[model samples]
Target: MHMHVALCAVLDPSEMPGGYRFEAIENLVLSRLDRLPPFTRRLVMDPLGLDHPHWIEDPEFDPIHHIRRVSCPAPGGSHELGRLVGRITSRPLPRDRPLWELWVVEGLAEGRFAIVAKVHHSAVDGMMGAGLMVNLFGMTREPAPEAPPPREEEHPVPPEPRPSDIEMLKSAARKRLAQPRKLVDLAKRTVERVGGVVERRRDPELAHGGTPLTAPRTRLNRPIGPQRDVGFARLSLAELKAIKAAVEGAKLNDVLLAVVGGALRRYLAHHDDLPEVPLVATCPIATGAGRGNNNVAAMFVPIATHLAEPEARLEAIQAATRGAKEEHAVLGKGELLQDWADLAPTTTFSVASSLYSRLKLSKHHRPVHNLIVSNVPGPPMPVYLAGAELEAAYPMGPILDGAALNVTVMSYRGQVDFGFMVARDVVPDVWRLADAVAPAFRELRDAVLGAPSEASPERSTPAE
Candidate 1:
């Protein structure tokens, strides 16, 4: 069985009751659920069923394991968490059943709850995960606990195959030949996808983000890391839309990134540095068009808040972003990742990621991107499944050696939530980054609405 290759570095330290421990939080989340929903929970609790601290032996295994109740002593809170996550996520999943794990974390600044859950990329995609959150959530603080569903049917494990050298050669050749056909198929898909978005604007269900397609390069858009430092910012979507309306042709997404640009600009200016060139952001284009895995790819676009006026910043983002969509039209993601895979094998990729772990590292390698910025869509309406009301949602992403930061945002019914993950060594004050993002939004709102920024967008470069 192929372990779904997902690197959902599974860490987000949330503020909670100081006295609450890791197990308590896990139990709390677990208790909030109505019943142990058969098919899914069985998958989640498989490792626990075998009762092994390490379930590496199970042939039909669950790739994700959630360890809990960990602490960070003085001199290392976020750093320690970052280390722990890096160590856990960098290894290859054992050749077992399902892949994934959920860890309950403790010892954060505000007595927060940290969830480090990962799944094999193959088993669950991003939107599915987002969708699951709704069902998993409770509607109210004191939700009515529902009855649990019957347990799923369990079966015996199967044997694994040991391939010979000749078989491996044949497999490789076969996979290689399949590529040409895949490419041809992708070309046909390219036309179909183009028709879906632009020509088919009738399909409002299309998943989209604010920034444009053809963004300019920024100093920040460099190769990135396996270790990440994460932070979050929450805002009102209504207010954002109001600002978008105020500014002519200002899309809400453009306003969002312009706000980030303004914040990045200010953050950089404080350090007395600014890039002569604009920054580039690699945003995701969701391809859950009922296709196979990784139905997403990055759209490299420009961040222009560095320009003199907020209006110019928004316009720059729009122009550059539109161009980007046109280009992404022809670029199929399946082929792109194959090119990426050739550059980084799964094992070496796993080992290289080890450097980002709590352990030590070598100095010779570079990461794939400078930073990761993702914006995921959420239900416009509130949803409930288990019991507990879905209070809030935040997106988390992986970090590596070179790229110290990842910023992922998820917009729920009424609020837009932002999550920033960084390397503890690099961004010591993740909360401070949170502070930066909020004001960035306000500045862009004023600019979009023809209001004055509390402060102008300062000029700055990516962290040195």
Candidate 2:
């Protein structure tokens, strides 16, 4: 039930006067705490059984507890940093405090440093997380001090009174009493939506989107343990755009999926586990509205890994994603899913999730999807943090019980960085899969560009 979204960003060493210092980093974090949105300081769940879980200000909020400094082993490189991140991600955030942690890591080779930020998925979606980063970071290497606007002397506003447990229970009971009518309304809307979706599917031109429960099972789709592993890869955004230009109606996302398909094909073949059928990926699409977090719906895209030729795989992925997008549009921005989720009993959901984990029920059924593949666009220009130039950023999403692999790609500056999180026992050599992405993109580049000159290795930062 603890789903956390984490991201790591590498910073240029030259921007800082002798690289990053713990004192300076701590001071910067403390200074920005007051400027953060109020939600960042809130904790969820009520101590009394009065109302459903809600956010309240953390009475004992401590800045030092949230921001920390860590160091890597000597000759610190991507491998050490990635291993540290894996360990950090495996640990659940403390429930009694705000659900976010930021680690300022030093000792990277060549005097470089990294910042790893983890926040509960309940607090922010991918888009909101990126927005928070932009807020905390600076647009320039030497950002001017934020000045508070001058205000005339006035009486301070009084603090609002907190609701009593009895009052909260009364309000909740009233809402519960209305559930029957709400359920009826929801049922009617769901039926109408399903009918509309069916009508769209009946159209011959819009039938390519595959049906649910049709995804082929693979090693990646199985029950997972609590432990996890993470790896990272970087690709040239320019090359991805170039490949997209070569194919009509192809987008950056389509090219990324094709590249991932190629990489998965190679990795699975090496392990003698390549499936005859194409692998399916659940791509999370933003609904653009929610409580400001978890505002996403998902679509299943068939990654044409079974196709031998890179060009054919790219083309198949493009068509598959196009159909998925159309299907998502017909579904109307995931309103149905959200509506049902809103009515779900919180205690029942928590108990069910815990039981499912303990019983390992993920292994009992056919997989709904093989893995999660998400793409989030990041700042096109370089960003700075406390005077350090940000070099690269990689986002890591949560791995579910049935889906052991989560691949998240973020485009920053001129590069597309890929973060892979996997079940430690299932994918011990996850770095191999990450390393395969570079050559996979190269193969696609050769297919699209017509010539096979040496692809620039500089475009990639493979985990060692």
Candidate 3:
């Protein structure tokens, strides 16, 4: 999967010092590079393809290589900016360099600009990606104080020369030699989890997280092309929290998923393609231990898109999330998934993925899930980069081959920013789904808290 994650931030340059200048912004970001690790590291794959890739400091690391400048076309609006972002994300990061880039895009309307930070998924996951953005754009207008020294575990040793091929092979072999013990442990855990599943199935009160390949085939489950389309949506964090408080047993995430389900229902019904059964979403659950690593597990959740009423959908989503979490815990959270990955040969996965795509195997089988929905927490207060105020920040996650759409949400300041990334050919009118999010939220809010005295001011990037 040539997947990368990104955050597209639209800046209000009114507060910027001397307005927007590409060189000024570039220098500012370079000055703060010490705070980021992945900015200077390049991937080094195992020669025998027996192990996961290792990251090492690039001897020829240059800030200018990763930092770039671009100009938005005329009538610079959200749609124009999104188009720019789509083009940026379509390309893969070169392995010869550190897998990241920060584009300082100028020429936005009202003298606004944007920063699109793209990083390879191999270097960072949702948590680390969000952290990198925050660090890049400090909390205030001034340059941040010298970042404290990284803990020993964060960067145990100073940068060293690249390991020789023989050295890498020996390290890979050592890990392979220990795999039998890992396999035995994995088998034991698998048996225990199987028993747990059986026991849970016997309990009437227990709910299931749903299984893979059970999702109904829809227009969304198709092979994706190289091109991408993006859309933006915004929700008030306070309003979401209010609804969470009003509804019994409802968490913020449940409310968020309910909004997505309602939006999907509207979008699909508009297309006359609404499925009779509820749609399943592959929700990425964080494992909490690996702060800077891709420590995540998948939980398939029934989004209750078939439910007509907003409150009913919210209630169903709350219960579904609970069930998913329970099942996830039963599966040892992410440990089981990580163990299996560690035991498998890395090349086997690469070959299988290549074959799957080459043969168009997705059409021959039920889709694994409908789409990927990820929730990432962002800074609570206003953040600035080089003296520019961040108006809106949309976090984008990579879409898969079968599931060609990804909806990633981030709560920044008081607004929850939704980034809808879809394969251009699969969901060309992604703007419709993006535009539906607010109305969906309003319907849910009214259903739970009753009508408000006045309409809440809608805040969103004006994407076409």
Candidate 4:
């Protein structure tokens, strides 16, 4: 999917040492950009489609052009904020400047505020995006004293100038010269990987990974529009840990997958569209060894959404993920995915994607997978941005043509925040899906630790 990512951070100004003001927070966010390279760079594409685009320093970069302030609508709750975010993310970032934006949102409930940071998928993956935001924050509410100005000869290196068309063509020619050899290697590796998978299939104990074009069709597997519907859910990390501990050999990720599977099962059943077969989810794993800002590979897992019982689903997910990990280890870390990506020209992808969307080709073919579920690790301790106390954090991933729903979960200060981004037409009443997360958690918890003496109430999204 060609898409951008947005992370919403709800802030409490009451905890700010110097009190809250929009100008002060905006200025504080702007002051941190001097050290981030992606903020100051613009993408320069080859006019003749000879090679991939290049990131060059923008000589006319202006911080104000990228960051702006917006007031939430009436009620100033989760629904209002989600609508505002959906509108903000639906529009594409301008290609003429840096592929990023920061919106300082005011008028949230209780005198609080929010910071919505948007960055293109080309600029950062889940891990890299989280790191970029962490750079702007501090360990405490009190801002650390600024470092002294650099003395003579201590200045940073100068930014590179934009290259001319002739220079770019020459570079592309040089790169193309080595393509034949790399292409040969890519083919050999591809054959070997296929052979390995075939051999693995011979072993009865070794489970096979998910295959493309095999997923069951559903309402989510269709073409999507520019409009998006957003939903937020907050879960207790402690509860998740307890659930994980209940099942032998189950990881925290497996628990998360189980919760999502249960929720999807209920949602589909509610609509009377639940399929007999289990649903497939494309889980992204960060390799930390790939090229460019997005250094991640995908692993397809069969989420047991077809199962009726939550505990049974958790066990099934645990087994499936174990097999997936073993398969990934055998396949190696993203080398095959990267090599294939490198062999394709930038223009080919851009053109193919455009045609696919324009022609609505996805509706005529088998869906790659049902949806995308990403798990991003975040700060364990309470961190402050500028002077405001961080209350909630929700990160959203991009939705694809066939897979119009994306559920991205992030861990922050003992809380697991879930952000849901879906096509407006494909899935109306997104909050219905979000609201199901708590019951899913409780169902699993009750199965494991037995029903609590006192029932724990459902969790509402922050400021709702």
- Quantify all predictions' global Cα lDDT against the true fold: 0.51, 0.79, 0.84, 0.83
lDDT score for residue 339 of model 3: 78
Position 27, candidate 4: lDDT? 62
Q: Candidate 4 — what's its lDDT?
A: 0.83
**Per-candidate alpha-carbon RMSD to the true structure:** 9.5, 3.6, 3.4, 2.7
lDDT of 1 at 113: 34
**Global Cα lDDT for candidate 2:** 0.79
lDDT of 3 by residue, 134-196 (tens): 878877777323433333322323666898888888999999999889889889989999699
Tens-digit lDDT track of model 4 for 1-464: 43899998898888676677666765665566665668878888777978888998776776667888899997789988888888788888898998899998989998878988889998889999889878877787865334323332111225588899889889898889999998998898888876787788689987766766788999888898888878899988887887888778999999999999988988888888899998999999998775888999988888999998889988888888877777776677677888787778888988898889889999887889999999999999988976788988999989989888999999998889999999887887788888889888888888877874243355667767
lDDT per residue for candidate 1 within 299-349, as digits (tens), equals 766676468576788888877676666556645543454444543324455
153-178: candidate 2 lDDT, tens digit per residue: 11112223445666666766776788
Q: For candidate 3, what is the lDDT?
A: 0.84
Q: Which regions in candidate 1 have their CA more than 4 angstroms from the true location? A: 1-64, 67-97, 105-116, 120-125, 138-173, 177-227, 332-369, 383-386, 400-402, 451-464
- What TM-score against the true fold does each predicted structure earn? 0.63, 0.92, 0.94, 0.95
Pairs of residues at least 3 apart in sequence or in different chains that clash in candidate 4: none
Query: Which candidate leads in lDDT?
Result: 3
